[model samples]
Target chain A: MKTNGIELEKEILDQLPAIVLAVDKNFNTLYANNAALTFMGSTPENVIGKHCYNMVRNPQCKTPECCIAQAMADGKVHSIRSEADGGTGNRFLESTAVPLKDEKGEIVGGLEFVLDITQKVLDEKKLNEQGRTIRDMSTPTIKLWDGILVLPVVGVIDTNRAQHMMDSMLNKILSSNSRAIIMDIQGVAAVDTAVANHLIKITKATKLMGCECLISGISPGVAKTLTQLGINLGSIKTKATLSDALEEAFSMINLRVITTEAKQ
Target chain B: MEADSFRLLNGVKAMMDSGDEYSVSGSVTNRCYIACINGELSSAQMGQLYDEIVRMAEKRELRGVIMDLNGLAVLDSAAFCVLRKISGALALMGLKSAWMGIKPAIASSLVDFGADVDDLCICQNIEDGVRLMSFQK
Candidate 1:
């Protein structure tokens, strides 16, 4: 156990898993643990008494935005993310610098801790990219048959997301020049009156744009809510399932999905 | 004696007819507890709002409550359940409530979720909702 003072115990510093470097007020590396030597590929004799930038070789060092410089100025801990050259490849480091104070409660120097965070950073970036991909794939417009564009909504329909769906559906309808659009909500977990009303608005807007909008996938529970609320969605065409909606779409365009083979 | 009697406690009996259009944070006026939906209310947040409404109702001892959803932008199924519970609790207190200015989309969603909205009175706007409570009494 070491006393609470600016003087750091060499035993404690050497045992730590991360690279620990003690710096004087002049920003000189007063002491560097064994891990720091292995990390920088330098020995104690060559590393100590050297400027922090010289030993670490970081472009950001000694600058106003440097973590060590910030901690020294504010007398608090500051952290920065930087890349370091590893034996195999480039590694990410989370460097934290804290103010070191003497027993008299006077700021003496800075204590820095550098942790390897290469794997963590890579994992986070992958997760973010995957989330973006999922969002992009969530809204898919399918042309099941000619003149019919089906947009199957499978997630929560909030105002912003609903707006996104509207924009995409309109674009697909315009491009396909489809006379009808079928919105299937079979994958949606729940429907509130707000969502029902949102669907109606989209349908009305589609009609205004000279396209017929039909909603499908009304579960039994959803039907009960609509009837009890005394809300009449009769003006908007609806079907029990996507197949039924597709059949209706076919009728609107004067076509049908014929199952019979051509006779000789 | 009565909850609305607090207005008379201040010794001002001659009241002007502002037509029940003023807003009070958490109080009852003209036998109605009116609050505008101004915050983002998830199901959890609705519980906090519900507790406050119940407290105000018990204190003012009002007979009617009106929730104004004019500025509301976000809500979930939890909000409807909380409203249902609040309605049930208020019913036991011999007080009824109404929802005003509900966006058509939200109403459609509530209806789609199989919520028994017949128990709650609804109004197209705040002025119409305030008038509803007055007519009921």
Candidate 2:
């Protein structure tokens, strides 16, 4: 069927999941689709001729910055993310407005279609929080002894991750007043020249704080790779294993770890 | 000398020739000479502070010198270079130098700027610096 001589498939518009509405230049609601009427919790008779802002209160509502106003002014389609208040409570909506013209191509009203993005927005927020938690957990610093701290690094080392590791290690050393730090990289997938350089930087920074840094858990492959790369860790100590590093740390702090005999 | 000692113990404010405000206050606590540095660190200020510290070290038996940088927010490369020179000079004079209260950001920046701080002893606070000095002795 057609509305006002405009070919509009009313059946398709009514079946659409998105909320569609037509509003005049003054922001008065002219036509509300089935989804729009349902979202407003009102019938077409009560919704029509009502002010759009009075029904859906959003940040851009009642402002010249509204998507519909922008589309009407520019005679182009505009889209915006709006937190709209509807029958289902406050929801995130991606609203797109297209300028509606007559036979003369003069702007008369605008058609706005809004997609509820509340779930998508919630998912994105949850994902961001999880990423932060993972970033923090990836660099865990633990105090192994009175004056020694150990950091277990697990994963691919990027520039950002390396910087984060450095920050975490430095802060831990400051708080713990530890004289030595052992970075165990057994879980590291691989190490390149860049990663080696970052490690050197960490050592230098820690030394400036009066903390000796020792790198441990160097696999045979990593050791060969370092030699091939000709990356000198300089004066920073390196150990083949965490056990050896721990022993060296204990010696630095004048601590001796001895195993006791089993009791009968 | 007595007035100097009193000033050193009570903390003295040294105004540079350029009218910049800085201080190098020294006090003997736990037998460790603690020098509290404040205001923006400059080479000239460090030079004056070094001369005063060396003169004082000549008269007194010092376990070590703890340079407290708690009042500082940013330590530039020039200041760090001056600090390295001071650390070396202090060592030659038989006085160990331990930097105390270095902020984490400053430490990170120092390394990022490629400052050679390996020869210098750094401590978390005055207590740790004093302990480190005693341990070294």
Candidate 3:
């Protein structure tokens, strides 16, 4: 039973997620747990008896804005968000210093807890980039086709996305000197009134640029939405499927005969 | 000197002198002054300055903050973000904030980088900015 209790205590200490360090009032390192050693990239032998600031190479210790010094002076808990270079690169860490008290409630030392939040910060940045990429893809703009632009737009067009789509498409049409453009929306779920107006604007922009924009892959539901939106598609060239759009685009640029001959 | 106490000034104008990237002038309603930074504003310096500004705002209701960047050749994104946050915090304290003396090239670069300056009141010169904030009084 005694051995089991000791093993349980060891297990709990090892399983703790935070790096824990105990330091003297002067900020000298007294003890460090396994997690702390791992975090600092050092062993207990090298860190023991050294000033914590010296070990971490903290330049602010000599300055007036030292949080550790303030905590020691007031006997209060202090927390700071700081960056540490852990041999790999700079990493963000949340460090908390709590004053240690003895039986008589006298301040003896302090315990420092360090938590690495580098992964969390990186994840948030990546998520933001992904959101921007997705928004750029959904918007009807020619910017997506800078290097042979291809848009496989699937789903309904609302007022907001439609406006974005028009802007993107017009910008691309003016910038790129491509002979033909293809917009495939075979899986589109629906279209609204504002969406129809945006479509008209896109067609007008393409005509002004002297480049042909082909719409293809329309579903039955999309066709119904188009009618309800009161959009006149009489002047716009469209195809039943993406394959049809490609064929039409090639023909418009006088590349159909050459491509057919090559295939044959 | 008391660690937290600071003199208040109404306006601050800084210009670079003799290899120094920053200089300060005018009354500081807040403890801190507008340092017309010509070069880099390192993270450490920014953190220290921000801490001082926060303390000053808490002690005395800081009325205005203006950062004149007439001589600044480069303004990094980190510095821009810090300024944005500081401006937002000052606004909460009913203090007016403006960034003046920005060169046309730097302004264009900021826009190209997609830095949101829409919330910030910007001026081409310090005098114009002071005039804009005069209504705050």
DockQ scores for all predicted structures: 0.01, 0.53, 0.02
lDDT of 1 by residue, B17-127 (tens): 232223335445677778776756644557667777888888876767888775666556777677778878887877777776555455444544555554466654445
Root-mean-square deviation of each candidate, in angstroms? 15.8, 7.8, 19.1
Residue A4, model 3: lDDT of: 73
Taking the tens digit of each residue's C-alpha lDDT, what string does model 3 give over A195-244? 65556555544443334667887778878878776778887788898777
For lDDT, the strongest prediction is 2
lDDT of 1 at B14: 41
Q: What is the DockQ score, from 0 to 1, of model 3?
A: 0.02
Where does model 3 exceed 4 Å of error? Answer: A1-17, A21-34, A37-83, A88-113, A116-151, A154-176, A191-210, A229-264, B1-137
A69-122: candidate 2 lDDT, tens digit per residue: 999999999999978666678889899999999999999999999998999999
Q: After superposition, how far is residue B121 of candidate 2 from its true place, in Å?
A: 1.8
Where's the lowest-lDDT run of ten residues in candidate 2 chain B?
B13-22
Interface Cα RMSD per model, in Å? 11.1, 1.4, 14.6
On TM-score, the candidate that comes out on top is 2
Error of 2 at B4 (Å): 39
